[model samples]
Target: MSLVKESREELNLIPQVMHSLINACVGMFASAYHQAENKKQNLLRTDILTEQFKRLLLRHIRTHKSTSDYAESLNISPAYLNEAVKLTTGFTVGFWIQQATITEAKRLLYTTDTTVKEIAYLLGFTDHAYFSRYFSNAAGHSPTEFRLTHRK
Candidate 1:
């Protein structure tokens, strides 16, 4: 009887978790589409486009880290992407990608018990050492150190 109850609880939990995940995914897609539309509504609105790009980049940085990839997704030329991002934000698209990657890495480090290598991989980094260097360059500390200092 106790085993049956436990099985029921486990089964209920799975659907709840799946429901939450599905909702989150739907929210993310909605946000991305909204950002893309804002960019399209005004070609001269480079600042708005750049801001929208940042939102999109933050949501998809793990999968789309390259400027050219983002450009292609937006149906724009790489040079145009770079120009708009730089003109409005004073930073290139690559810079935004690096910043977004580093931000996500920090969030994962502080929020999860993942190892540095795992966090690097989670952030779409191909090489752990390269991630370490990148983090150190932008964050002023290594991933392990940042995790240790910021962990609550």
Candidate 2:
């Protein structure tokens, strides 16, 4: 019966307090895990969409250059496709499409003896001048300059 000593009732209540604390800790951990899982799922879905877009671009690049065209083929809205691309690549849909087109143009320039006008037409560019401007803007030089510098 010392003042410092705990009674049987107090000792019984100590286990109850510990159990509540453990439950609270578990609940917090569970909530944190759930949030992390949701973020991972969102990232996975964005990555899948980005991969699909890239495959479609590579296969039908000459025919389908517009963001809306690619999005429509993929059964998604253009805005959503853009959002997913931005999330995965930190670039807009138009930027990716433009880059893909330029990459193909460069490949054709380097690998084939095709003239700039013919290459532009092959890439579905209606105007060779517009293609030249676009190439200069993106590649920092005209297609001729790129071909000369890269030619073996």
Candidate 3:
């Protein structure tokens, strides 16, 4: 074997493991650098998302409406709302809306003895399949699985 192979054999690690470890280290370093940049940007523009987030949270928790509705309520275009949300939360307006709705759905599924259809409509999804699809996409499981996990 070569010197490199000998060194790796001494450490009981394969060449692939060494490459993977180096890649993981680089990934972690890049993540930390990006996080620091994000922190600096947030410090420079604190609460810039407060109004929009507040409006979003209120309209969402209260009514769980669509992004277009929220953007119209805020009197800006949907694109602008999406941009604001991305700047504020690292997510688009639609993402937050869908995720928030799914979160509420999870809460109901885990805490209440409610039917999936009822919870679906309660969270503003006109159809149960739509709610199920959205919930599964966000939680990596179906609402029934979620409920089963948390059943009392």
Candidate 4:
């Protein structure tokens, strides 16, 4: 008779113990899930900022040549903009700006018969000599050289 009563008591305690264990497991899972969600949201926000920065760069590459310029337009700090862009695209903001400038310069050089000085001015460079040096450094050739070699 004592053994039967003890067994009944143990059986009654099992439900309470199981309920506590289940609640703990649920709490842990919920915490992990919320953490994952927050991380995903942060990454998504960074990606959006990166895309916005790229669009601004393309639209204002000729006029806005500085990282601060684009960062200001996007309402973000230059450091944060660069960090977000670098994280999402694996490159800095200045790199994309330079690429946009050089790509446009190349297109104009290849397709038009504009003088190098005129091309430099069109690209928002105040000095043709400086433009030439910049182009040479980024493109591995002078503007005139690129035109001559690339133009058939």
> Worst ten-residue run, lDDT, model 3?
44-53
| Window of ten residues with lowest summed lDDT in model 2 | 1-10
Task: Please list all clashing residue pairs in model 4, or write none if there are none.
Answer: none
Q: Give the higher-TM-score candidate: 1 or 4.
A: 4
Stronger candidate by lDDT (1 vs 4) = 4
lDDT by residue (1-152, candidate 3, tens digit) is 69988887778766678899999999999999999998867662324543666566756663746667776776777777777777766877677776677777888888888999999888777889987987898889999998988785
How do the predictions measure up, each by TM-score? 0.67, 0.70, 0.62, 0.71
lDDT of 1 by residue, 1-152 (tens): 99999999999899899999999999999999999997777667577667778788977888887888888877788888899999987889998898889888989998889999998888888999999999999999999999888874
Model 4 spans with C-alpha error above 4 angstroms: 1-43
In candidate 3 the C-alpha lDDT for residue 106 amounts to: 80
Q: Kindly indicate the candidate among 1 and 2 with the higher TM-score.
A: 2
What local lDDT score does residue 114 receive in model 1, on the 0 to 100 scale? 91
Residue-level error in angstroms, candidate 1, position 63: 0.9
Count: clashes, candidate 2: 0
Task: Mark the regions of model 2 whose C-alpha exceeds 4 Å error after superposition.
Answer: 1-43
The TM-score of predicted model 3 comes to 0.62
Residue range 1-152, candidate 2, lDDT tens digits: 66446677688899999999999999999999999998877777779999999999989888887889999998999999999999999999899889989999999999999999999999999999999999999999999999999995
Order of all candidates by lDDT, from best down to worst?
A: 2, 4, 1, 3
lDDT (CA) per prediction: 0.88, 0.93, 0.76, 0.92
Stretches off by above 4 angstroms in model 3 are: 1-50, 62-64
Q: Is candidate 2 or candidate 3 better by lDDT?
A: 2
